[model samples]
Target: MMTLSAPLLALLWLVQVVCSAFPEEPGPLSSIPTEVRKYPVFLGRPHRSSLRQEPLHIQRILQVNRTLYIGADDLFRVELDNVVGDEMFYSKKRTWESNKNDISICRMKGKHEGDTLEMVGETVSGMARCPYDPKHANVALFAGNLFTATVTDFLAIDAVIYRSLGDSPALRTIKHDSKWFRYQLNKMVVDTNAGPHGNRTVLFLGSSRGTILKFLVVPNQDNTAPNNNVFLEELEGYNPECGQDTPQARQLLSLTLDSNSHTLLLAFPSCVVRIPVARCQLYSRCMNCISSRDPYCGWTRGSTCSFLRAGTLPFEQDVDHGNTSYLGDCDLLQESYIEEPDGLVSVNLLVLSAVSAFSTGAALSGLMVCWIMTVKHRQRSRGGGSGPGGRRKCEKEQNMLG
Candidate 1:
């Protein structure tokens, strides 16, 4: 075997130590897929009207290309790109409990200078009393029609879906005699494009318990029902958690859908939970349906996927944190979908390289100091040795002096 110098051996040992200390490369942070194109769309801020002190409880958000419409507490606000101010419209009855409360619908028209949002139509469906203590009215538009539901006497009161006919004041009801419309209290309702055969679907969420129910409206030959109206059937139902009468269950706030991914994001007191629409469609279940491929179904960093615990702020807090607006109603506006650049991998590589460089420098510096000390110790021992060669040299010097 070839002999190696002390410094060389020490350097080899140092490298081995470093290799053992750190083996795997740090992974990159995962991100959702981005849309292809983007336009500068705007959404108005909710709770802009002073009469309502509380921020407008955003019930439903709809994007029709670049124009965005937000339905909140019996008010529909409209905003358009290049437009300076938001146009507000209030339905006849403002509170959620009144018998004559109407669901409001707004659609954009014309160009910026002379643009307007026509109320078009309203519905005063008398179903049940508000279930929540301070119950708020909820409204949503689907398949070119409007659907409103409120909690009354601890039961879900859904208005018969209505379709608007041009600028006329006439409102038609969607006639469907299916058992799906039966009494089960629904606190919030959201519209989705994931109906059977790609038709529009409505997702209803329960108030007292976090029960998610889906209803599909399919077109039928029954002209007795309107052309826009179809047979309403219960597609699926699942409870996110078991213990209903607890604080977590009582905190059941609202539900929203990400149309792009078909993901259902549910909000409570402290945390937000995500459920996959694809998984729900396939399994007809919600429990254990959360998977990596699912959106918002996973937990936030260093947090559990269960009920959002107390002491943690809601995701909406990110909106006005530091007085910075996160996403206003107008900002919810969507144009052509824009693809976000894939920079996560590059960022991870950069971070790993920096850390590796720093660790290598620290190890090399330590090895260099140890090597110098070893060499000096060896030299000192040799000088102090009483070996045969050193003794003969000392004897010769003494004899010459004598």
Candidate 2:
């Protein structure tokens, strides 16, 4: 019999003792109420222009009541209604596109009966391009009274932010003095409900280094410029390490703000990160966990936790198992659930490790016993065979007697 070393036996016994002490988690009961989790909203594939070979650049996001406004590369603006359905319906009545050279603005109206949006009104600006380049323009609505757009340009290349006065004929401009190479005006969050008299702030993603830059745009009483000049002020900036090259960074493909809390939700390839506006400076981030009040964190197939530099929350339970398909990158907007029928439920790592070790010990012991038995049987068979000399002697004695 194979004998286990003292240390190995003790170790195996300890594991078994611990496993016995810790009871297996009970299965889900029908009587218990499970909390449903919500996921980040993901829009469909970004719209790109045929004129340019570059993929569509989703430059800015504007959330107005129940509608979402999207600004993209090649001067395209799209509006999506906020409703639960297979395909998000776009408003066909209001859409705009600017010319390639940044000369004129084209306003188009769309009609949507069910799911299809058809173009209706198409108005082109008299000027082929705006006096400033549209490439650098960022758009925002301020105080429900004025729309402002700002631009920061390099050399002859201009960056502009455009704000249109709802039905008014006038347009406002907020110009940037600093030299900029490449930049993306990503998102705008208006904290009207928080600040005095509903102040507005805009968030943008700077190119090359992927810096998150924020700007405050408001009505300026001291207007010296002709374009109903609006004041543009820099609020704050953060480098999410999101860049065009790094896979982890690139996964931060999109961002949006919670309408109620104004918390920023950054969508990545694997998981979504949430940065509360109050704690933006500290870079305090929270990720979705298998069990968290935060709508973005939850359990799915192949679910795993990646510790942020700040580590995880104390109460947060690390995910132990599940497929990540429900947590796909480009599809964060869809809601998910941790149903009881979704295969083996998650378990504690410590428990699993201990069980595996004990099973391995048992298997090794059985193998040693089998080997010893086989050797003993072979020895008995050899002893039963007669020697050649003994057999010859017996035959000679029998011949003499005869």
Q: Report every candidate's CA lDDT.
A: 0.40, 0.40
Report the error of model 2 at residue 179, Å. 6.7
Best by lDDT: 1
- Candidate 1 residue-wise lDDT, 268-355, digit = tens: 4322334444322221112221221222222222222222223333321110111223323322231111222655443335667999
Worst 10-residue lDDT window for candidate 1 reads: 32-41
Give the poorly placed runs of model 1, Cα more than 4 Å off: 1-49, 53-77, 80-183, 186-202, 205-366, 381-402
- What's the residue-level lDDT of 229 in candidate 1? 27
lDDT of 1: 0.40
Candidate 1 RMSD to the real structure: 25.3
**Residue-wise C-alpha lDDT for candidate 2, range 118-229, written one tens digit per residue:** 6888774522124344443445556655544444333223444444434665553455444443344544444333222233333333223223443333345667743321
